[model samples]
Target: MISRPYDEIKLLIENYLKKEFSTKSDLIWSKPPSVELGDISFPLFNIAKELKIKPEELSEKIIAEISFPDIVEKVNLQGGFLNLTFNRSIFVTQVLQTILEQTKYGQNSSLSSERIIVEHTSSNPTGPLHIGNFRGSVLGDVLGRLFSFLGAAVNVRYYVNDLGRQIAPLVIGYFLLKEAKYKIEEKGDLWLGKVYASMYTFLEIQQLKQKLSMLGWKIKDSSVSLYRLDDTDLKTVPEFLNSLPKENEEKDNTHKWFMKLTRIQSSLIERIPEVYEKLNKLTSSKIENLESTTNQYVKNYQEGKDKLIVEKFREVTKIALDGHVETLNLFAIFHDDFDWESDVAWSGEVQTMLAELEDKKYLRHDEKARLLKNDIIAEELGYKTKYSISYEIPDTIIINSEGITLYPCRDIVYHLHKLEKFNASQCYNVIAKMQQLPQLSVRLALYGLNRTDTADRIHHFDYEYVSLIGRKMAGREFDYVTPDELFVLAQEEIKTIIEERNYSEEEQQNIANKIAASSIKYHILKMDPQKSVAFDVKKAVDPNENSGSFLQYSYARALSILSRSSKHDINVQKILESTEKENLIIEKQAEWELVKLMEELPSILIKAAKSLRPDSVANFSYSLASSFHKFYDACPVLKAETPELIKSRVRIVFSISKCLESLFEVMGIEALEKM
Candidate 1:
């Protein structure tokens, strides 16, 4: 375990207060405004009041009476405040020695007894994951990593939404377009995405044409009675057409929408002409039954009434999901389990829950769907006031008239499944902000069903969208960059940088791949989860500053220094052992600043875990790297004037490398020995 110097130092002061004043102090600690003032400070106003001594006088008494530990160099009394400066030599030795002694230096048992389930990136298996989906994936994976680092038993799962409206188009397209001759140059998910997008666009175009035709007929009908006239009306067709309603807003709007659909259709056709042509034929033949077919496929699959349809649904979904898994594996992001929505739907758990809720009078039926009585539950539990909720929460649809289960209900059942499967104490669903209502409704449904304990433990780990500049993504239209495309874009940017380095083509490509992955992951993880990210690939991969590549570059630089040093120059054991007899001085200000920044890693990890924000850790790693760069620029490790200084600086570099490696593991970034 790494020693927490700040915490230990604070405890030492508390003991001093107890010994001198015979009183316990709830001490508040903060850094001095300037480094020259001291390392840590606390006020004497409250303690002086308790001891019946003026604060100014008390400060002097404490300085005279206090027994400073080896960790504290001295204490300064400034009016009512006491400032303690650390013995830099001892402080530096402790931080480095403790970090070297531990396997995972900053890990703690803070969540040792906790059993947690984190479900993220459960995008419907309709298409490949876009940049938006990648954000949640990285966030969730990093979260699981952080919790595990905190000694929690964490299970990271991906909820496969195998059965939903989103997947219906893909299923229909699989059979209808299987024999169609479209190019298969892209990955499975990308190709399937085009199929899905083409299906929707084609259907929309068909519907728009029919609508325009009907509106035109209505205009002609309004101008003349077709049943009353024959040859005269026909010969005067131009006159009657002129009499048609000229300022119809609905017709104008319909034309506008038709134009828009045509654009989307054109783009889809351009990408996959065979798919568009086949869809056109299918629609022209019997498009009226497309809806019924889609609904029937969903119903049959859900009820397990048709084995062939169910197999096809699973097959298509698996292909898309496999593509997703492959793309995420590039960045080292993975899930411990893939929990299927259909599996939970078919397990009889949803039905059993519905039966139980019905028995308990929590379930009710409306004209449109079966709803859970959320209002009654909220009133009974006083959730409005208890949880400080301001808005009204309406009843949530558990099952629609088509006999298909909705998301919230299936989600509730899945939560129970996860909880029981792992016997987890809490379940976290990492979904987008758009699903807040549904997420809350899941909790309300659980509460209404007399499982308030389980309801309270369910967490909606929500986040905002991630958009690429100048890129508009419509999932149904398939007009977005997949993770594969994003990675390619990143690799292209990196190629320009590493091409001039002393590496072969293969090595350069490998380095580009690693840097690209780190750039994307760090960019997403460095932002506040509640804030949307407008990701810039160039900024993400910038090696100059404040990026993952910069951090990696810093680590590689440290490794380079260590590689060039002799065994005697890099011996940390002798220095640490000698610290007991005498101080190991850190002479340079840059060195001292760097050591102080490294000391905060443990506290930073704890704060991030407790606050559910990985950005804190991301930002801290950047600061640490930036500080190391400054130290390296200011001090020469290999060319030091004395062998002792060289040995000390080498140890600093080694400790920093270890610190960075641990953080890389937590952030899912690759630590490159060479870049």
Candidate 2:
């Protein structure tokens, strides 16, 4: 409803300027700083300067030349600015009526026919997701919802990295641990997480031994405790060896190896206690065999030759994905497709892509590996200076020395497949900021293929990391917090707040879960994508703070008001359509302010969608909730002096509730009727 009048005003101003000045200008409108001024303001300084006339005189002439429609009640010129005020009573009534009639009042149809794909949360299937990955999940999920609300044919996808180096170790660890009869009763992903960490520690110890042996140092006691490195005198070995003072060259060599050993030992001591026992159980021969087996597993899986290895990989990957799905369900995140990296390799899509590149003369084979010759393509696309800082552009490697396809190469095939399969014109990869270079390389590869349409439409919705207590979380470290853990913690906190309420046990649990999930989502999404979030669960669930629960509680409060009014047998429809001017009176400043905030919803939605930032909508939700609270405090609904006043206030409350519902829908927030 607001967009209609806003568009009408823009067209009116554009046509008026073309006729008056015999030239055209881009007419941009902004809101007045204060509600008392006007609904929209248009600055006249630019046009005034172009016409070589004083802005004050230009504003006056424009005010006299153009006539506002019935919707625009008054036009005032303040200095060099032209402000237009709407008929508040009529605009509010009409907007409320339209919101009541339309199921989706704030949605627009500008991109109704365009197809888009939003791929996100493509975490490797080696472990459960930490909070860092959850940030991207929330961002992508909200974007999918926002684009769909704006009438785009959006498909959400998750690219599973099932054929990466991480998966190799996961498979090896599962088999090795199963042979040891290690039983895990927890989530499979969590169990795999422990195994993966232990494997890394074991591998590190083996590498350290090889480094020591190269320096002619042998360990006489394999029974020495690997866990007590903190009490071991590793530094003394380097010092004693250095003090021997043999030939300068030999002395330096001994110093180097001992220092390297000390560093490795220090790293080993830093590992969690569980990794120590795993490392102690790994003999040198077993470690060597495990390394060879991991390589064989990857090779056979890639070549599609080993059925047992393939099935083992799939079984473990399915366990990890099951855990992923469970966590995603807690946040209400669903994807239209789950694209496996192995599928790109198995379906011959990757080979087909390589063949096409070779046909286009973009593929080159160096002595060590096959590479995509992007230097010519980069120059052709102006990538060196256009895409990023001039000194940061690097050539992309398509395949390594072992004839294995890299992730970026596989990503290129995956993206092209998505475009061809879905016929989508736009694709957004909601990945972390650390992968900016890889993402850029993929886009360059697309451009190199002369697929400029796909290249130009590829958007990297890059976001920064999410940290807890100034420490970033990594899944492989086994020290990070999981989304499931955070959900449990949030529920415990929310339970304490709602325990005294008269709700049943089941109702209490439901409310706690929704509030907990909402709090987590809001905390992750309330900030700009480019900024890092220091997550604090306590502040996130507080009803007094500008949190998700606060917004939900605000809606619930409005519902409570309306529920009370229903008992009075008030005819809401009759009150909304009342023709009596005095009965429609909104003399309170708070009511007018709330109406103004409600009127900005359509414009806010359009801006948020265009900017690809859900934070804008989140910020708007907070402001709307704040305004509603202010109105509730200042104006009385059921306690009004007259029946008409009560109806008027109720109408405003109902409109606020509707607008909030629309906003929550776009933000992927659950709007609760009771909290």
Candidate 3:
């Protein structure tokens, strides 16, 4: 909502400063911390650097000659920072008028109703949705909700890698059951999940047993269910070691154990497909009405080059599968024996993919460090300043033209083909870190894409690794904190503690869902993006203070207060209060600091969306909530007798609630009604 007015002021200030300094320099303007200080703060560093004069001296000269619009009340320089103060009466009136007048207060038209495809939570449809995958799901959903609230034309999608080999073992496991043919009852993702965890221990023993058997060694079959080797087995050890066949002093060892482990691993792997197939059947298909023709792997180029690559990729994939491992990495095993050159679809695409990579300059000529022709995609078309370099590195798996097996490049090629076909505004399949990004002194040097001065279109939409709750929970342990589960837990906890809050089933369910979701999202994203987190449960669910629940409580309470207030037209800026509230902002700084936070909403959103980190929104919500609570505590509203003061109080409530609503909604926290 403040974007249009804010933009106009920014331009005026920059132009004024440019002329005043008689030197064109990048001007920096920021939101002031306190509304009393003004709606905007302009740092004096750039001007100070140019003028060679102290900021205060520079400010007097600039303010005297600047000739700002009437809304600009005063400008001052303190601590080498030039601060601009706006007319409080005008500020409060206009902002309040906008908030009251609009049906959706604090809403902005910045999104321009663009068709945004928000893809998140593309976790393999293998098992019950785990907490680790919940980060992407919730973040993506919240972002979609925020975009919808902002008036963007949005479609939310959950990509399914239904075809990948991750499903194969599950598929295999399901068939192992005698009832599998008739019922297809137990899902493989569920069945193999436990099996997969146990496989490591299972394989460790089996692999060693096979190595002992290879030495023309006979084992006492009665002593053990499998091979039971003794000291005589040591006699069969290779001649170099036979003289001194020593056992490792270590209790558990990593040696000839792998041969037997490989045998068990292979046996279990043969059962994966049956297991995977059942899990796939369990999910209710939202894909039914999907009119998407893009489900099949597609590539451009009626050019014969692609088909050739596809075939070779399949050839290598065959070799990978035949190693008794069945599937290597991603491809599922073929149930029936097939030639390496099979032309069936979904059968050999990756090997064919690799066959082409052998032709590319970067793929074939690399050293032992695994050469990749990576594309580091920014969200938009423009290149970021080098320091902002990030990664969503995609690996490609390509098959060679000769049909020779090359193991390393498959991850890279698969990534490339998928990314190219999808063509998100800025989806880069960065082959590796070394080959991507702009070095220096090059602004518009990126390949093909435009590099204009404004924010690049695609770069703003590049994929970022979603922040997770507590090291982004993975494995089976993450089940405890999923938003889905936490949502219910928090609801029960909230219901018991805040008995005054009442709502119907639908309403309570919605609130509970929001509380649970917000807690998970905020807790996970609270840490800096670059840092790893091992989230503490006590910290996340804390209800007393500074926790997400505390913020939600404050928000719900503010809503409750206003919901009960009279619905008369109250003037927001009728009076400048004296006493505790008056000196609070100017003297105490904290109050003033809180007031300035109001102006930061738009910028915070812009920056957060631009950075592809929703944590920015989460952090702002907590801070805004804290500020509202402070203001609420210091000022008495319903008890005040003066009509004007009462009106002012009512107006403050309106603004605070509006801010709270907007912040919470953006983070996908359903703004609560009563608490």
Q: Give lDDT per model, in order.
A: 0.78, 0.77, 0.46
Candidate 3: where is the Cα deviation over 4 Å?
A: 1-9, 20-22, 30-40, 51-57, 102-118, 143-156, 163-166, 178-192, 195-355, 361-424, 427-485, 499-513, 567-595
* Model 1, position 629: C-alpha lDDT score: 96
lDDT of 2: 0.77
The C-alpha stretches of model 2 lying farther than 4 A from their native spots are 1-3, 179-181, 219-288, 355-366, 381-392, 470-472, 541-546, 573-583
Q: At residue 407, give the lDDT of candidate 3.
A: 30
Q: Rank the candidates by TM-score, best first.
A: 2, 1, 3
How do the residues 278-353 of candidate 1 rate in per-residue lDDT, one tens digit apiece? 7667544544545556677778877766889988998898989999999899989999888888888888888788
Among the numbered candidates, top TM-score falls to 2
Score every model by TM-score. 0.89, 0.90, 0.64
Score residue 495 of candidate 2 by CA lDDT: 91
Give per-residue CA lDDT, model 2, range 1-675, as digits (tens).
444566678789889888879645577888888877888898888888888899888878878888877778888888778899988766666666666666776887877988989999998887788888988999999998988988999999999888887678678777766767776788888777776766654554444444444545443343153322233436444544556548646567655644654454444346545543554464333444555666788888876668888898988898898888889889888888888888887887787788888898877888667777766667766766665545545567879997878888788987776776678989999999999878887887888877767787889999998778755465545668788887888888889888988999999999998888888788778889999878765565454463788888889999888887766777666776666554255778888878877877887888888988888888899888988988988998878888867877888888888898998898888888898
What TM-score does structure 3 among the candidates reach?
Answer: 0.64
Model 3: worst 10 consecutive residues (lDDT sum): 327-336
In the order shown, what is each candidate's alpha-carbon RMSD?
5.3, 3.6, 11.4
- RMSD to native, candidate 3: 11.4
Candidate 1: minimum summed lDDT over ten consecutive residues — where? Answer: 221-230
